[model samples]
Target: MEGGVMKEEGNRLAKEQRLRKAVYNAIITLSECIVETTTLQRTLNNLDQSSWMEVVEERYLGRMCGFPLCTNPVQVKNAQKYRIDLKNKKVFERSAEIDKFCCRSCFLRSAAVRAQLEAEPLWIRGDEQVKIFDLNAENVRQQQQDTYDVEFVEDQQLITSLEILKIGDTAESDDEDNDDETNMDEEKKDDAHKEFYNLCQSYLTMKSAVASIDEIANDPTVKRITDETVTKMEIEAERKDNKRLSESEKLARIRSKYSQNKFKRPPEIIEAKPFNSELCDKVPENLYQDFKRILSEWCGPETICHLQLHRRMNLSDSENKTVTEAKSIIAQFYAGDRSINKIVEDVFLPPVDNVDQAKQRISVLVELLKPSWRLLERTLNRNGCGQQALEIISTFRLSATNVILEKKMCDLAVAVIFRLLAYCDRSLMDFYPSDHIVSSKFMKYLEQIRCDAKCYFGILSIITNKLE
Candidate 1:
């Protein structure tokens, strides 16, 4: 009886010890689960920089209250106004009509309800009840048959080992057979355990590889870095495209600026005449007589003697020849009563050896005619012969080219030209062609000379005013 009691006590102690071990293991597993859950929550919070309160406010603002049993608006109000310390929680009160919660009470109640719903296990939720169905008789039988098959396989292995052992033993005793079968069964269990351990190790290795892949794929830092790199590449490409467009536009503008009037042709030559018939018709009898008197004085014997002395002193061989030819032509025009057109065409338009000869002949003519320029200007202005005077001056100016003039001569020429232009009709000025003195190229050349002279000239102001 004591032995039976001791045996019962031993069995009860072993059962109690086993139960204690299972409870300890359960506690450890629960603790580990809680740690894992907290770690996952922290990781998620770190990834999203916004606090839970801000997230909730952003999601629920201007929307209906989240509480299942309440109907209220949500609004963003000053957090300090709330009586509850909502810094660690997500709660807000109404300050306007658009608020989700009508009051602080409603917000708190909603939050509590949300927390309760989150805490409740899915299996215990009334709305999401899970119904477990029992296995049918055929399924139970199939499962049992599979278990029996596995046992049979193990037993077969044991039996084969026993048979091998028996072949090495000479004993035919039943006790020895039992012992050998037991040893074979133990060896088969050990082999099964080793196979299970190997399978578990392989499974753990595969799980670790999958977990590393997930970490690489889901890391926020990696994703953000990739996004920044793509944005930089796009920005660089855009800048390059903009730079290319700017360069093309700059080149186009430069071409347009320089080539604006480059291809324009020089003006055509017209019939030449010494006196304008239009001026003769407009001039009063008194002004016409004054003009003739001035012309006679300009061609008088004293002026002729001074010009001959000037030619002897300053004229080259070619220049003296040109001047002599010009004098003969003028004498023929006056003595033979030839038309002014014939004299201008034959005398002024004839080719010369060089620009210097042409210039010297022009200087001699200008010197001889200097006394008449002022008289011509006054007569034209008084008699409304401004257009005729301008035309005559422009023709004379065009006849002289590629010759550097003395400052005094250039000033005299510019002054005369400007005085004529000032009184002339603008329409008649435009009628003068491009190669004439009124053209852009001729005006620009005058401008360059004015700049070099640096002394202020009335011509500069006149030209600027006319151009503007």
Candidate 2:
């Protein structure tokens, strides 16, 4: 019976020891888990920097009804004004086991509250330039670079091993596939895998390149150097400005010193000569008088009357006196004893005796008229009575003695006639070769008559048509 009791006691002792060990292990594990949880929670809460706060239960001597947290001096002051006992000191200092770990939810709540209180709204001030945060393509590119760098550091060895394994697998697979069809299938799969691998490598290479770029972009030393360079450049620019001003002043002084005297020398005095050595000597005295007499006689009053007739008589107001008087003047010059009425009847009046004869005569005149119509055109253009002058010139056929100005009148007449013929009456083309009227003979005569007065449109038309 004693032996059975001893065996039972030994078994009970072994069971108790096992149970105690299990409880101790569970306690240690729980404590360690709590510590790890607190650490993780603190990190997530962004409270790696935190101060310890002790919680205490105090008994107030006065009537403080509820537990109100006295956060600030104002709260305490208010509580004191309400006659409430606000105790910040510990009342009972007794040792008690208490949990000292970060409450995951409480830590997050505190962090959020702190963040809310600390965060400032993005705002533009009236007097201050706001810092512009550009979170555009450059920011995203930088973020991508950071992510790639981390991924590469974490998986570089793994990727290299994976490649080795893939190559071995491919070799084995190739060896196992002996049939042509199976070999082709394996080759296609290998090619697909190679393409995938190459794509991955390309992505990694691109990512690595981007990361290196970011490293350069974010390098503080490079930024400092750039800022220093800009500062020096600004200083140098100011120096250059000052130097330029100094140089300008120096140049101004130099110019002032040299400009005291006039740079230009006085021109040499030159005596005026009476006449040139090559100038022609005087002409004979009688020759000058003869020339004057010829001019006076040729352009005298009778010539003026004849030229007026060429310019046409506006005898609607003169009882035909202008035509009659012009004929009388010419007769007076031509014949010593000729009656004005006879001279008029012979020269001024048309050869036709009646209206029927006049119409026939007009027909004959139109048929016999040369392009010397330019005479009236010139006389009319000069004297401002073009239509009447043209009628007179077209109608009258003066004698050679009376036609002293015939050449000028005829040349002017023919030029204007060509101008009219070139463009005016297309119907008259049957009667005259309009093309022949613009001939060199006609244009040369116009040049000799009109002098510097250019026939621009007429000349252009002639040149263009001839070239064509």
- With a 3 Å backbone cut-off (N, CA, C), the pairs that clash in candidate 2 are 374-412, 374-413, 375-413
| Number of clashing residue pairs, candidate 2 | 3
10 residues in a row with least lDDT, candidate 1: 43-52
- Model 1, 1-468: lDDT tens digits are 999999998987776665445434323332221224333232221211122233334335435442323344544555565445467776665354225565665555434323322233222222332222221334444555786784323445445555645534535544456765545566755775676566557755876676776698689998999899999999999778667677778678568767566676889999777887556334233432342233332232322332333323333433224446676556555544333343344445545665554346546555543444444435334333333343333233223332333433433444444433443333324423532234443344434433222222333333334333
TM-score of 2: 0.15
For model 2, residues 358-418, the per-residue Cα lDDT tens digits are 3354344343334345443343342232333333333333443433333333343334333
Give the per-residue Cα lDDT of candidate 1 at 335: 49
Off by over 4 Å in 1: 1-214, 217-385, 397-414, 417-468
Cα misplacement distance, residue 319 of candidate 2 (Å): 12
lDDT of each: 0.43, 0.40
Q: RMSD, model 1, all Cα superposed?
A: 37.1
